[model samples]
Target: MKAGGGDGGSSVSDEEWERFLRASLEGVPDAPEEPSARDRAAAARRPPERAADTAWRAYTPPRRRSRKGWYVAGFVASVALLAVAFAPGGVTGLFGDDARGADAAPLAPESVAPTAPPDAGPEAVRPTLAEPFKGSPAARWADGPAGITVPEARATGWMDRAEVARALRLSRDFLVASNLEPGVLRGERPAGAIALINPRQRDVQDYLAAAFRSPGEANDPVLLFSRFDPAQARLVGDVVKTRGRLTYAEGEKGAVRVTADVTFVYPIAPAGGGDAVVRTIVRREVVMSWDDPAKVITEPGTFSLVSYRADMTNAGCGPATGRLIPSFGGGGGGTASGPAVDPYDRSTSMDERMGAAGDEECGTATRS
Candidate 1:
């Protein structure tokens, strides 16, 4: 379906957001710069690199946005950068770099990553300060549930306006409770989110319950909830930057289908206090449907899961232990191998990245 944004993301149109993300993907420097004393210290505390350590360094966040004032100002800088970088003349001309004859639409960054990365520590950038996202694109993202904006409610097919509105509200609530709730993020069972699922879907209910109760390689909880190992790491700041849109359509059996594709950026630091902060990017696309109570005879405020898919960047390829294992420096986690794809690049749809069913593979990401 052709998805459109609601008033929630009115600050920037969908086309603008897409353009911003696509342009930001360009200009990534290749070589790792000299590490600051703080980064050197953080790297020293990390465990020795494993064969998969290349995966961790690949998840490093984008170049930090220099902040001159409050968070609002930081966001403005990102927008300004997007504007000039994609101006009529390419960024090379603006920066007095090599001239590009006539087609000057801002050439891609010179130092892009190779198809596969080498075994090395991540490039050092700015240090994590009181404001964790000060130097990242996430600085502009809305905090937590606020980013999951619901579209205007309207009747669709057999569903009434009220029903459509309720379906949207229920879907938004479930997304927030499942991914943003503080307890859920800390490895706790997503009880609030589960309570909103249609009990009639016994298989889905059972699967979710078992996933959290006995998490393993096959039934990992991180697929649905963004949980972290408390003993290993804690949130660097209270904010979790989020951006996405929700849309609804008519479904079979007098039902309304709601689709949400949202991207959440989390900044985490090592347990206790640590100098390094890393961002884990998760893009989740969930399809839920609510049938007319008269015809379906299901519980109120509950929806059936039509389909759910996700693509996580910078977080390891698998939830081996059932939680998002963010590699602070060069730590080990689930195995990852594949061509390097930029997590921030949103030019492609989620379906394109996830591919057809049963095509599961541990792919590598370009950056956090």
Candidate 2:
């Protein structure tokens, strides 16, 4: 990226100009005498020399005073042309250069309405909602009072740092202020607030980086291509209820992880329902790796490469074998393999216990 004003035009200085002039003229020869004043062939002079003189004599000479006046007139005309060409507006009587348009107005400090950039990538042009969904795909369990029927995900992993702590702090402040986290996830509702977030692993900073983010768009440091709304939330709910799986499992090692599969569903609603129902079967898993990964690897992200399959704490791994029997191939595609149900305290809330794992990096929060 070009950091400062372009072309170094602002860096020019008077001393530098003087140095440039000196270097340029260092070897230039002295001005030669004007040929017209050298010899006159008329009268006392040899009559204007040869046959070539025909063309020379055709060029008439003016009186000395007139010559001086002619020189002054030419100089004035040159200066006028230079002034017009280099004017503030850079005009040619009736036309302006492209630069003039750029310089015509003072830029606003707030923000300029961005013109479409020539090099924006795919999501740059995507239409996004003003609001976004909160709560993880697996959080859909809160949807069913019958109990979270979502498939039990075998997850394992450990945190290198305590990012979940920071996110919780911010979430606490936000919940206190708004009374409702924009993605209002009322777990078994009409009671207290747990502030579950929407799908974040899907809505990435740059999909390649796997940057972790909060569920709410309002708390985001910078805006994404777009936000989510109630309609989108209802859509998310449908997708989760139908075709989703949330794998949240903890190993004997203190490591913890969770994962889920999700789809984008839109325009879905319940029968005569005011608040839309979340309905979709998204397959998700969480993986937590230990300080020493040699122990376990079966949590959602434990695979590290293709999948995560372990969360190893200083304690040890559960499942005895530490084997993440592949449920599906190619990462949640092809077949739906049943997970080995060693729940190992499966009937509990993943967040309330070890808290959501950090799927992101450290210290680069954007300032809105």
| Best model per TM-score | 1
TM-score each candidate.
0.65, 0.19
Off by over 4 Å in 1: 1-124, 330-332
**Local accuracy of candidate 1 as per-residue lDDT tens digits, 1-368:** 01121212124443453454445323223322211111101111111222433433534333211000000000001112211111111011111112111121322221221233222334433326355654344555566666666788999956789878878877878788777776656765565676666654534544554454455545566666777777677766566767677888887656798878777877777776657767777878787777666655345677766666667765565334667767776333445443345554444455455544444555555455
Kindly list the per-residue Cα lDDT of model 2 for residues 1-368, writing each as its tens digit.
01111111213243443343234223223322211211111112111111211221222211000000000000000000001011111112211111111112222221111232111112211111211122211222221211212332232344423433332223222222111121222111101111122101111112211111222212221111111222222221221111223334443344333333222112122223333322112112222112123332121111211122121111111111111111111121122122111111222222311223331111100000
**Prediction-by-prediction clash tally:** 4, 69
Clashing pairs in 1: 27-109, 64-135, 65-135, 90-106
Q: In model 2, how large is the Cα lDDT of residue 359? A: 17
* Native-to-model Cα distance after best TM-score fit, residue 135 in candidate 1, in Å: 3.4
For model 2, what is the alpha-carbon lDDT of residue 116? Answer: 26
